[model samples]
Target: MGSSARLRQFVHDNGPLILDGGLATELEAQGAKLQGDPLWSARLLHTNPQAIRDAHSRFLLSGADIIATVTYQASIPGFIRHLDVSAERARELLMSGVHLAKETVTRFDSGHQRPLVAGSVGPYGAFLRDGSEYTGAYAAEMSVEELKVWHRPQIDCLAAAGADLIAFETIPSIKEAEAVVELLREFPDTTAWLSFSCKDGKCISDGSLFTEAVQVARRSTQLLAVGVNCCPPDVVEPLLDSAASLQSPDMSWVVYPNSGEDWNPERGWKTSEKLSATIPELSHTWLKQGAALIGGCCRIGPALIAQLRRELKGDCTPAASAEPS
Candidate 1:
């Protein structure tokens, strides 16, 4: 079967596939200083790639079926502007994100089912590094074609570098989703999943309805799944209900919400103690709501992923815990 078909079949045979959580979160917990880094976790592709590989391995050992790469902030233009790297070098760094993930998966693939490597193509606001990703305000001046232009090189590098698929994650607008769907035609064989960053139960970060966003994603033949991420877990079931009306049967709903933390560009994550719950306890509710690809986001670590695996699969094997640095 094709990779996309295999993913769907995996969800059908087993329960929902478990996606790995928070690449930057895990990396920061492992002593990587991401604060004020222009490229965020993508900076490790240059200074400490082994750390990136180790992050991927921790998720694998924790029973993640898919590991998203450290390319969330690895756009070529952003690299050129921030790091003063040549376009060629920027492309190499983007490709390195996939290679590190694939290499990590290979190293950790014992006798178990191998995990898929997903190249994370984060929203354009991530490159801005001004918290616009959560509000979609940075993209207000951009057109869909302009968005496509900005995303092309990163998507191009990831696709050429042999990621199992691309993850257009944390998108906050329908225009961005339209651009991603249109960009998919550039690489006919590469499958992708479009996940939005919602602001509330009914709307995306841009205040547009998620139903409209899902409707835009549904236009893509290369899309394997569509849903929300990096949002509050409390809002996922309602968003899923809205997305359900627009998605086809073959398309799965991928949900990996944050630990109810609010991000401040200057101060970083501020957790909500009242909303804090173990991901395992929350995964059951997410699964009940028909989330086919479940996981965590910001402030969620390997221990939570291991707990989810144990709860869902009955495997209590411990993995490397990513303690806060």
Candidate 2:
């Protein structure tokens, strides 16, 4: 079956599709250092591919129905700078992310529901590694066409590499979303989900209203779902409320918030004691609000994904937290 059909069928057979938790978070837990790397976990694609595969395997075993590849930061320009390789080799590295995830899923399939592989395409700001992703402050001179050009190869490479769907995730602006939707036309058969980073319940990180962002995103025929990611859990429900009034009934919604913490470009992530909502609790609430694809972003690991699976399936059995001893 095609990817859209498979997704609909899976949602009908099960509840909301369970996406894997943070790939890089679990990778760091596995002892692969990611500090100061432009490619982040994508660097592991060259240094230790098995680690990426193992992260996918853990999420699958944790009951994730969809596995997003580790290409979130694997842009061609970033690869060239980090790996010191040609553009051709950079694209190869991006394709390798899909291959590693696919290979893992192939080995883990035991005749149950097959998990969909989502090729991750992060924002242009991510390539900068300067925290502009959360702020959407690209160089003022960067034009929409330039954004399209910068993203075209990654999207084309992912589609050509045989991903089931494109995960245009953590998008901080409507311009980038439009660029991706336009680039996707070159590959008619490919479908994508465009999820954004928001500053509040109603506004994206760039200070654009979610209402406006969703309106722009819903114009794309290639988009299977549209919503928020890497935003605070406290803001998701209100963001969903803002989007509910704007989204079409046929359009699915995706929500994968970070652990309600702060990310400093120079110092990395820091926890906040004031944040009380746990991932599993917020996940149930997001589902009730119409999130068809649910998972976690940074700081969320396999154990929490397993918890979400149990919560969604109505399994009350308790499970261990992120760091099980």
Candidate 3:
């Protein structure tokens, strides 16, 4: 089946999904930079929009069924706070992120069809300088009143750009997911899915149990799928089990774990140092359990996505070719 049809069917059958991440980190590492700037993406957004689209194309070519656009770091608050860009410019960058996806898809998949665009919605705040922890992540600053004021413009920008579906990712808390859902509700035409970041097994960054986040999301949002991203691959097992324990296996669980082995701010999270091991060679075992949707976080690129495609769908031998454990 075509990618869109396959994705819709995958959602319908509650089958395995292969979604991709790592574009922003990849682009920034390549030539694009996000240093000391929240809206750090704007400088490279339109000029290097293709860099992200290329990452998407790489994933699609590698067998990823879903391609998350390069909007994870493209948040309004981050832009206003860090980039210090005007509202008009921020909106332009956000729309450009969406449009770049379309441009890439049209160019690469014109005749061949098999990849869906997932408009990425990242944290409202920012990741810590160390990269080991997520920092400044608040969906709302004060009351629901305060939250709405913060999220409106960015949410509207993604909707206007015509995202197939919203991918609210890397949320370490339920409140943030709720905030995103609440913002989405304002627009009758928009649809969204929630994904959380699990710390240990039980709680979010704020210490709310993963179940608390999942249950509230299930009850409150019109989330199409729910799972975790941006954590370590090792964390996947417990996070999935936690969700399943909550009686939510029927709903698809999306996963994109960091390939890194160790994450320390001062030590740095260089791509080479991170994924010291090959994925799915070990990860697909989780696929046997749950993990309908899977991909990589920081430092992961086309090769890993390709391996996932082969392991999950085709006849590629994973354990044999992978480096010794």
**Model 1: pairs clashing at backbone N, Cα or C within 3 Å:** none
Residue 35 local lDDT, model 2: 75
Please write out the lDDT profile of model 3 over residues 1-325, one tens digit for every residue.
4333444465656346677757766666567765555444544674566566666666666666677777766766555566677878878888777787766656554233345667777665443333422532454344555655666776678778977777887776666666776777687666566777666766766678787887877764346667777777766777777667664533556678777554455554644554425566656766755666778877677677777777777743222111111
Q: Write the per-residue lDDT of candidate 2 for residues 83-198, one digit (tens) a residue.
A: 89998998898899889888877777534567789999999999888999998888355787999999988988898899989999999987887778788887888888999999
lDDT: worst 10-residue window of model 2: 316-325
Model 2: per-residue Cα lDDT at residue 42? 91
- Among these predicted structures, which one has the highest TM-score? 1
lDDT of 1 at 129: 88
Please provide, for model 1 over 1-325, each residue's C-alpha lDDT reduced to its tens digit, 9 standing for 90 to 100: 6666876776687767788888899989989999898888888888889888788888877788889999998889877887788999989988999998887776663455667888999999998889888889877799999999999999999999999999999998888888899999999879889899999999999999988888888787678888889988889878888766676778878888888888899999886765547567767877776777888888888778878887877876444333211
Please name the candidate that would achieve the greatest lDDT relative to the true structure.
Answer: 1
Q: Which pairs clash (backbone N, Cα, C closer than 3 Å) in model 3?
A: 17-292, 130-265, 260-274
**Which ten-residue region of model 1 has the weakest summed lDDT?**
316-325
Question: Rank by lDDT, descending?
Answer: 1, 2, 3
Worst 10 residues of 3 by lDDT: 316-325
Go through the candidates in order and give each one's C-alpha lDDT.
Answer: 0.84, 0.83, 0.64
